[model samples]
Target chain A: MDLYSKEVMKHFRKPQNVGKIKNADGIGKVGNLRCGDIMYLYIKVAKDKKGKEIINDIKFETYGCTVAIANTSLLTTMVKGKTIEEAMKIKKDDLVKKFGGVPFIKIHCSLLAVDALAEAIYDYFKKIGRPISKELEERHEAAEKIGEELKKHHGGLFKVEEELHKEYEK
Target chain B: MQKRIYPHTTTRTENQRYFNRERRFLFGVGVYLDYAATTPVDPRVLKRMMPYFSKKFGNTMSLHSFGQEAKADLEESREEVANFIGAKLEEIIFTGSATESNNLALKGIALARRSSSGGGRHIVISQIEHPCIMESAKWLESQGFEITRMAVDKFGRINPEDINKAIKKETILVSIIHASNEIGTIQPIVEIGKICKEKGVYFHTDSSQSLGKIPIDVNLMNIDLLTASSHKMYGPKGAGLLYIRKGTKIEPILHGGGQESGLRSSTVNVAAILGFAEACRISKKEIKKEAERLQKLRDKLIRGILTRVPNSHLNGHPKMRLPNNANFWFEFIEGESIIIQLDLLGVAGSTGSACSSIKLEPSHVLLAIGLKHEQAHGSLRLSLGKWTTEKEINYVLKVLPGIIKNLRKISPFKA
Candidate 1:
C-alpha cells in the first residue's frame, strides 16, 4: 500500500515551479552533497499600496525524491498569494501535514523544501533594504535559545554553537 | 481542497500504449530501498579504476614493463579482496562472475575429489541454494556423482542439524549460499561451517549478495570456500572472486598459461578487479552508515505499503531480513505489472531477481518458504541501495498503492 495520497503523486509528477526566474527578487539555494538532496528557490515579491508584501511569482528546482518534489510544489502553491511574513512562518511539519503526512524517512525532504522557502524570504528582505522583521528576529532568538539549552544539557554538544551564539548576540 | 490526482488516469491506452510511454521516468530523490540486487558503484572505486583502462592499459600476462605494472595492480587487487574476506592472498581466484565461481567451487572440488580420492563423490547443497550452486550440483549428478539437497524452514533458512544429518562419508563438498538472494535471509554459515569442519568435508558458500552488505569473516565463519561477485557490491560486472581457503584442493576449471595460481586461466581484468577492490574498500568504510540509513528507509517503505494496501503481506522475515531488503506479495496483483507500472512512474527496481525475471515462473525462493504459487507469482522486491534517498521512498509510497489498485482492478485473481 502507498503512504502518499494521489494528490501528492500528481504534484510530484508535474511539479509547479521547475525553473529559475532571471533577476528574481529573492533567490535561495540550499542543500549539500552530504545530504544527497538539493533545492533552489526563486521568488518575485511585490508590495501593495498599503505596504503589504505579496509574492508575485515563485519557482523552484529541486533535485530530490518524490516527497521533496511534492513538498516544493506544495510550498510554491502555499506561498504564492501569502505575504512575506506568512511564508517565513511556514514550517516543515506544516508542509508535511499538507500532504496528509509524509512518510517518516521523507520528512527530512519536506524540511529541506521549507528551509529553502525561509531562505528565499530572508533573501527578499535583504534585497529590499528593509531591516529584518522583529517577528523573524524573535523566532531566530527563540531557536538560538533552544539550541543553547540543548548545548548546556549535552555539555560539549558542539563548539560551533558558541560561535553561532556570539554572531547572534552581535 | 483539490481532489487527489490518482495515478490510475495515466494508464496507457490499448492501442497507443507502446508508442507514447515515457522512456526515462525518474522516481525523484527518495530513499533508495533496493540495495540487495546491486549498488551504485562508489566514485572512489571508479577513480582507482580509470587509469588501468586508458593510461595503464596492458595485458597482465605480457612480459613487457607495462604488463608487469598491470600485473602488479592485479595482484594488489587480489590481496585487497583477500584481506576483505579474511582469506590469504594466494587463496583468491578471480572469476567472470559469482555463478562462475560457484560452478568452479562445486565442479572443481568434485572433479578433484573424484580424481584424488575416487571414493568421496557425493555432494550436499541446501534446497535454497542459488541457481548456480543448484545447477552445478545437478550437473555433478548427471556426471554420476550422488547429490543431496537439504531442506529449509518457512523463512528459507536451513538448519545446521539438517546439514549434519545429510552429510555422509561419501560427501565430497557441501555448498550453501551465505544469504538467500530473494528473501534476504542470512544463513547460519558458522554453524554449517563447523558441521563441515567436524565431518572433514569441504564447505563452500556463495557469498555473492552478502559480501559487501554484511560482515564477512571467513576465518570466524569457518568457510573453507566462498564466492563473491563484484557487480553485487557496486563494482563493475564480469569481475568476481572465489575464496578457496588454503589447503582446500580443487582442480582447475580453466587450464591455460597457469593464471590465478593455476586454478582459473585468463588474462586478468585489471580495471574491473581494481574497481572491485575499491568497492570492497569503500563498503568496509561506509557499511555502518549505509546499513543504518537503508534500514530506516526500508522500515518506512514497508510500513507505508503495509498500512496503505489491505490484505498485502510481507514475504520474508520481518526483522531478520537484510536492512536494504523489502519483498511484499500483493493479494491480487501480479509482480510484473506492478514493476512495469512503477517503471512508468520513473521508479527503477526488480520484481524478483533481475536474472530470473524473464522465466515467468513463480520465484522458487518464495515457494520454498511455503508461499502458494499465486502469492509467489505476485511478489515484488524493493532492495534499497546507497544512492536511495528519502524523496524516492516517499514517491514510491505515494505512487505504488495507486498502481496496485489499478492492477488489482484488472487482475483475474481474487484477494
Candidate 2:
C-alpha cells in the first residue's frame, strides 16, 4: 500500500504555480471534497503564428492526497507551453508516467487532472464562440462520467451541484 | 493566539529548516500520538514476562512438576485479569486476539443458542463495533442467524432505547463496543446492560479500547461476555481474553486439547499471558492518575486544533470520549494528506479513512455518526499515551496549523 511514488512526494512538496488565475481565459474544475479530491485548472490562452491558441499560462489549486495534488501540479507544468489542442491530448497515462506510477486506487487523481485540463480547453473554445467539436464534447462527457462513477463508488454525501457551489463560496 | 502564516512561496530549505528546528526542540522522541493503533510493551511488563519465555516454560496441562509450576503461574495471570474486571477466575478464557475473542463471543453464542434453545437465533450489535464484530455478524448471518445492526447517533452513541426496540423474542445476545477506538465515544453500557438484563438476553462488549484506559466493572455493567486485547494496553500482541460470566454457555470455536475450559483450544502463550497480566495490573494501579493526565492533554489538543484551524471540528461526544483520544475533521483537506504531512513533520497519527482497504471506505464509525462521506475522509484520530509529553503536544499544535493552511491553499474546495 505504498500508494505514492517519489515523484508524487517531490511535486507535492514543491508544487508549482498554485492558486487561481485572475481573469483567466479558461477555468475548469472537477471533483468534490467528499470524494476526497477536487482540482481546479486555470489557463491563460494566447495565439501563436498561425492563430492557433497556446496555453501561455497555467495554474492549479487542489485539495486531495499526495497523488491528487501531485498530478494537478504536474498537469499544470506539463500543459503550460502546449497549444490548446496539445493540452487536451494530455491523458491520464501521461501524468502517471510523470509520477513514475501511481497505485491503482490513485489512478482517479490522474484522470481528474486530465479531465480538468480538457474542460479548461473546452472553456477556452466556448469563450471564442467556436462550435464545440464532437471529440471535445465526448471527452468532457467521459470526464464527467469519471466523477459520477467516483461518487457512485465512494458514496458521496453532497450532491455535485451543492459541492461545487460550496467550493465557489470558498 | 496570533495567527501564524508561512508564505507558500517560501523555499524548500526554509521549510526544512523550520521543521528541523521544531524537531530539535522535542529531543528526538518523534511524537507518538497514534497510541490507539498499538502501544510499545511497557518495560516492566516485558521484564516480568521474560522469565516465562525460557526459564520456567512448561505445558500448563502436563502432569508433572514443571507443568505444575507453569499451571500455577497461568492461573495467577488469569486471576489478575479477572480481578481487574471484577470477574471470577473461571470466567476469563485466554485467546489469540480481540478479533478471535469477538468471533468466539458472537459465533459461539449464536451456535450454542441455535443448537440448545428453540427461542431465538438473532443477535444485536451496534454499527460502530470493530470490523471483527461486524464481520463475525456477517458470518453469523450466512449461518442463518439473523443479525440486527443497531445505529448510533451523530456522536457515535448507540441509544439504549433503540437497543430495547431492536431486541426481539428470537434475539440471543447483544454486543456493543464500550468505547470506540476511532472516535473515542463512550457508550452508555450500564444502561444498555440493565435493559438487556430485564429482557433476559446476554450482553457482550468489546472493551479493547476502554479496558486499560478507563474503569470497568462487569458486575455494575451487567456485561456477560467481554473481549479485551493486550497489545492495545501496552502488553504483548499474541494474548487476549474473552470474559464469560458463570453459567453463560458458548460453544467451543476451536476443538483440540480443550484448553481454556474447552472454550478456546490451544497451548497457552505463557510469556504473552504473563505480560498481559502485568499490563492489566499496572493499568489498574495507575488508571486514575494516567486518565486525568491524558484528559488534560486530549482537551488541550482538541481546543488547539479547533481554534487554530478554521473549519475544523471535533468528532464524537464532547465529554463522553476516551481520555486519551481526540478526533477532528479538517474541512476541504483529505485525512490521508494530513496524516502524511504530520508524519513528515515528526508527528505520527491516523486517518479515519483507511487507504489500504479494498473498498477504501471512510471510517464506518464516522459514517455511522452521520458524517458525509467527504467529511469522514477528512477525519484525523490522535490518541495520547503514557509517554506523551506536553512539549510534544505543544509542538504538534504549533506545526499542524501551518500544514493545514498550506494544504488548504492548494485545495480546490473551500469550507
Highest TM-score scorer: 2
Tens-digit lDDT track of model 2 for A37-102:
667788998888899878999988876777788888898888887887788778899889888988
Count backbone overlaps in model 2.
Answer: 7
How many clashes in each structure? 23, 7
Fill in the DockQ of model 1.
0.01
List where candidate 2 sits over 4 angstroms from the true fold.
A1-3, A32-35, A49-52, A129-135, A145-170, B1-28, B64-67, B354-358
* Weakest ten-residue segment in model 1 chain B by summed lDDT: B18-27
User: Per-candidate DockQ versus the true complex?
Assistant: 0.01, 0.36
Each model's TM-score for chain A is 0.74, 0.79
Clashes of 1: 23
Query: Interface RMSD values for the candidates, listed in order?
Result: 21.0, 4.3
Using DockQ, give the best candidate's number: 2
Task: State model 1's lDDT.
Answer: 0.74
lDDT of each: 0.74, 0.85
